[model samples]
Target chain A: MNFKNFITHTLLLLLLALIQIIFLKNLALFGVAFCFLYLLGILNLPIPISHVPLILLSFGLGLAVDVFYDTIGIHAASASLMGFLRPYWLKAISPTGGYDDSAKPNLPEMGIGWYISYSLPMIFAFSLVFFTADQWGTGGFFGVLNKSILSSIFTVVLAIIVQLLFFKRRREIR
Target chain B: MLRILQFLYSLRSFLLFVLLEVLAIGLIVSNNSPQGAAFFNSSNAVIGTVLKTRSDILDFFSFAQANETLILENALLLEQIKALKQEPDSLPIPLDSAFEAQFQFTGARVISNSLRFAQNHLTLNKGSKDGIKPGMGIFNQDGIVGRVKSVSENYAVAISLLNTGLLVSSKIKSTENFGSVNWDGINSKQAKMLYVPRHVKAQAGDTIVTSGYNAVFPEGIRIGVISVVNPASDPNYLDILIDLSTDFSRVNYVYLVENTQIVELDSLHKKSEVVNEF
Candidate 1:
């Protein structure tokens, strides 16, 4: 990534993390589902980034989140897992023509179908690990599953809305 | 060596993943373990300051409600003063002076509170600097809140009565039948009273007050009122519900009560135990 893009990504990550901690941390629906908009930073990373940096970034992001939530390491663990699986997910869902090096994996760069297919599994994986670690020894498997599914849905909806609001599309050349 | 290097390189991502997960789990385990008096959970300065700022903004919106509560408490205090003056020979002493020299009350503001968790906790703005120590009992004008769990320099975390782990030694006001009150984790507005014999005539409106058997709280602090009574399945006790007096959702200001005589009483009890053993 160029220095300009690197700076932009860092600023975006900070903004998303702040919003998650300050505002969305308290926003729970029915006391079960929670919105984790901070995952948008991880999900929207450029597709060409390698696995090591991606996983490290995920860990850092999760740790930042954990500091605010007062949860020691649960978010970091889950974010690392999500980062580890992102490359495989991109490879598995590659379109008829391969992804362009310049393309970013966002709503504007990729259509709704590709974005959902790519992001949903990553969000679900992250949520499953997160809620499982959070409710460990206190709740049963069914409870974990229910929380993960509901939270994933809430998180994905919020993430999509955020993308639509902030992620601008590049104009196509004739 | 080349093959081994290739293998290691190929598995580097997986290794990193495992290493990070182990570190995270290690942190979780260490955090959950019982540690000394250091309030490791939520009393950190940064988190406390952030929460305090948020609470301050929210407190601004609830100014009117808070004012009403303060006015009511002031009126009650005045009435108590008037009643005390009516007595024949008793000299009027300051409220704090009336208690033994060992007890002190530190005023604290509740900066963060939670009711939804099975184990809920409240963060207060006063801490060690304000003489707020762990084991100090907290109460609002209406009733008992909880005891201090841990304290940082300027912040203290109290385990709220809504938490499942807290049990207040209590008795019915009319019959003086002793029991313990605990949260059943079902309702925020209600708690369960345990160990009361089934034969005790506990009515729906009977009041429950602290028995002062535990050194944590003084005698006769109001806890709640009996709301429901049913025979326990064990056939030895009654399953009673209490309508909690202190509306925890609205509790902002609280008094942290430090019992001065607890150490003396505890030592005396220990001595008596030794004598009995002999």
Candidate 2:
């Protein structure tokens, strides 16, 4: 990757992690505390980033957080799943080669509507995997099911907002 | 040899990603077990300092209100002491023998608190070094908050009733019904009290207090008011939901009550347990 692109990705990745740790982890709404939604870093990666590398990057970040969070391998697994599924999602949501060739995925390349649609399913799936794996035996099978669904809904709502605000709008698709 | 060099050169990025993921997954798997140590714990220097700074900034607004609350509580406590001097009847009832050795009070302030979860923990400004030990009762002006869990120098953590693992023994005053109060993990305004006998008459506004059976919190310390009572047909217990007297979401400062004579009482209790075990 070019230096500019490389720096941008690294900075954004760290920034997302910083925001997740500093703000989101501490947020308590209703009685249920929200989960960290930092996996958007993997999802927002430029299409040029190879799928395996993207997945690995997300897995690494998620695993690091898992250590601090005291949860098991669930986050790593879920983040990897998000990385693996990103290509399929881009294909499903984008209209045939429907991306700017030389630009990163942002609001300008993918309309706000398209971007939201693209991120929702990816985030929802990752959230389900993460919550289900953690709450697995703790809540029984049904408990896992309950946590997966409940947390996905919450995670998606928050993730979409992150995309809209920070996935910056490129002036012109290169 | 040529193909090997080509493979390494062409797939280097992919290999690096795989290696990175492998390391992360390894850590996650390790932490899953019961003895699995905390991996991403915020106690790390980089995360801790950043989190601490941010937590302080967000709470700065409330620190002022917390200060006011502490001042108001001090005033109220002073007034109660004055009233106690003039009229002994107004004092919290002198403990009956069973409870005489169970409860003690020590003052503490919230060094850090977590409320945004299904289970929450609070850290106090006192710890083992300050003679504060785990399992001690933590309370505030309105009522019970939680019990101590872990302690370090000058700081201790309490597993708040919001935690599912916590089961504090409590009783309803008027009916003498006893139960364990729990947070729904869904509501800060309320908690669930279980094991209350269905036969007892429980009504809205009836007082629920700590039973002191656990020897952690003293008996008759206000827990909450019974908001609803639901009974299960298969069991003899009733579900008692309480609107907690204290807004747990807003607890900033608290009193860490240390039962000075815990060692003596615990030994006696264990002796009885050992006999029963046989």
Candidate 3:
């Protein structure tokens, strides 16, 4: 990535983290669904980003968010898991023509159908890990599953809306 | 050796993933203990300042309600003082050292709080600098809130009563039957009262208050009211649920109470080989 691109991505990440810590910290829909909008910061990175750096970046991002949430390691563990899974999931769901050198896995570039299929499972995995760790031996399996499913759906819907409203469309440039 | 080294290099990402996961789990385990001094939390200086700023703006909207509550509390205290006042001619009695106060109270604003998670916590604006210390009990006019888990220089984090991990030693005021009030992680407004025997007359509407057994809270601090009583799967105990009085959602201000003689009390318990569970 160019220096300008790097700077833009870094600022976007900081903005997302700030929004997450300040606005979304205590938010829960019906006391079960939680939105993790900050995941978009990692999810929107260029397709060719290597796995090692991607995982390290995700771990750092999660740890930063975790410090604010007072959930010391839960987010760090889950977000890194999502990061570890991202590359494989992307390859498995790649388009027949495959991705461009600078393709980003965002809604505007990947289209709604592709985006939902891509993000939903990844988010679901993230929510599962997060709630599992949060609830840890206290909640039953069904309770964790219930929270994970609802939270993933909630996060995905909000993430899509945010991308649509704020994220620039690359298709117009093409 | 060369082949093994090459294989390890090829699986570097997986190894790093495992290493990071293990480190994260280690943090989780260490941070879960009630007495553990956590390093990375909202109590850190930079994060605390940010949270305090956010609450400063948000607390403005709740100022009227907080003022109303404070006024009501002041009026109640005034009435108590009036009732206890002696005639001008009456001789003052000098109280002995036994009558000295054992708890110190400090007022603090809750800069950040979360109730949605199974393990909820609250961040207070006061810290060690303001005489806020770990193990101090927090409450408001509504009821008991939580216990201070860790304190930084300018901020403190308390494990909320709604957290599943915290257990407050309490009793039913009407029957004097004691139990531990624990969150079952289902409802934010309700918590489970454990170890109340099946035969104990723990009826609905019975008040639950701190028993002062653990010395974290003084006797008779309100916890909640019993909302549900049912037979448990374990025939020896009753399943009793309480409706927590503290409206955690809107808890912007809190009072911290530190037991002055807790060290002595704890050391006594240790000498007797007793575990203080709360």
Candidate 4:
């Protein structure tokens, strides 16, 4: 990425982290669906980004959030898993013409159908890992799965709303 | 050797992922144990400052409610003082050593808190600098909140009573049957009272209070009211649920109580080969 793009991404990551810590910390929809909106910072990175940096970035961002949430390593572990899987998921779902060199896997740039197909399962995987770690030895697989599914759906809806409202279209940004 | 190096280089991302995941899991395991000191949490200086600033802004909107609660508490304390006041003509008697104060209380602001997670925690603005220490009991006028888990220079992190790992020693006020209050990880407003015998007459609306058995909290601090009493699958213990008195969602200011003689008590327990459960 260019220096300007790197600066913008870092700022965006900071903004998302702030929102997650300040506003979304205690928010749970109907006491189950939690919004891990900061995942968007990792999810929307340029497609050409290498796996190593992506995993490191995800781990760092998650740790920053974990420090605030007091779930010390839970978020970091889950976000790292999500980051590690992103490249494979992106390759599997790449469209016929394939992604542009500068493509970002976000709703505004990737269109709704492709974005849903790409982001939903990744988010589901993230929520699954998060709730699994959280509910470890607590028993009730159904409860974990219920929370995971609802949280992923809730987070995706919120993520889409945020991207639609704020993120610039690829053409406009370029 | 070059071919093996090439293969290792090819699997670098996977190896890094495994390394980081192992590191994170290690942190989780180390931090999950209630007695282990937490290394990374809101108790850190920078995170504490950030959480405090956020709370400061949000608390502004709730000032009137907080003021009303504080006034109510003040009135209650004044009434208690009036009841305890000695008559002016009464002769002063030297108190026995048994009458010495065992617990000291301090006030703190809840800067950051979370309830959605199964293992929830809260961050208090006061820390070791303010006489806050790990294992101090936290409560409000409404009910018990939690115990301090770890403390930094200017902040402390507390495991909320809603955390599945925290078990508060408690008893039914009516029946006098004591048990451990444990969060079942299913709900925030309710917690399970474990080890209550199946024959104990626990009922809905019965009050639960700290038993003083654990030594972390003084006796008689309210915990909650038993809302459900059922025969558990274990058949030996009762499945009793208590509606937690502390409204954790809006918990702002809290009173922390530190036992001055906890070190002595802990050492005594150690002498007897008993584990300290808090």
Where does candidate 3 stray beyond 4 Å? A172-174
Q: What is the lDDT of candidate 3?
A: 0.92
Q: Report the Cα lDDT for residue A129, model 2.
A: 70
TM-score of each: 0.81, 0.75, 0.98, 0.97
Q: Could you give candidate 3's per-residue lDDT for residues A1-174 as a string of tens digits?
A: 889888988998899999999999999999999999999898988888899999999999999999989899999999999999999999999999899877888998889999999999999999999999999999899999999999999989999999899888766643
Model 2, position A152, has a per-residue lDDT of: 59
Question: How high is the lDDT of residue A109 in model 3?
Answer: 83
The candidate, 2 or 3, that scores higher on TM-score is 3
TM-score of chain B of each: 0.83, 0.73, 0.96, 0.97
DockQ values per model: 0.46, 0.33, 0.89, 0.86
Model 2 Cα lDDT, one tens digit per residue, A92-146? 7766767667755555566667766877677778766765554434345564455
Please give the TM-score of chain B in predicted model 3. Answer: 0.96
Worst 10 residues of 3 chain B by lDDT: B31-40
- For candidate 1, lDDT tens digit of each residue in A60-159? 9998777556565788999999999999999999987889979898988888888888888899999899877766664477877877788888888888
* Residue B47 accuracy (lDDT) in model 4: 87
Clashing pairs in 2: A67-B39, A67-B40, A68-B39, A68-B40, A68-B41, B106-B257
Candidate 1 global lDDT: 0.83
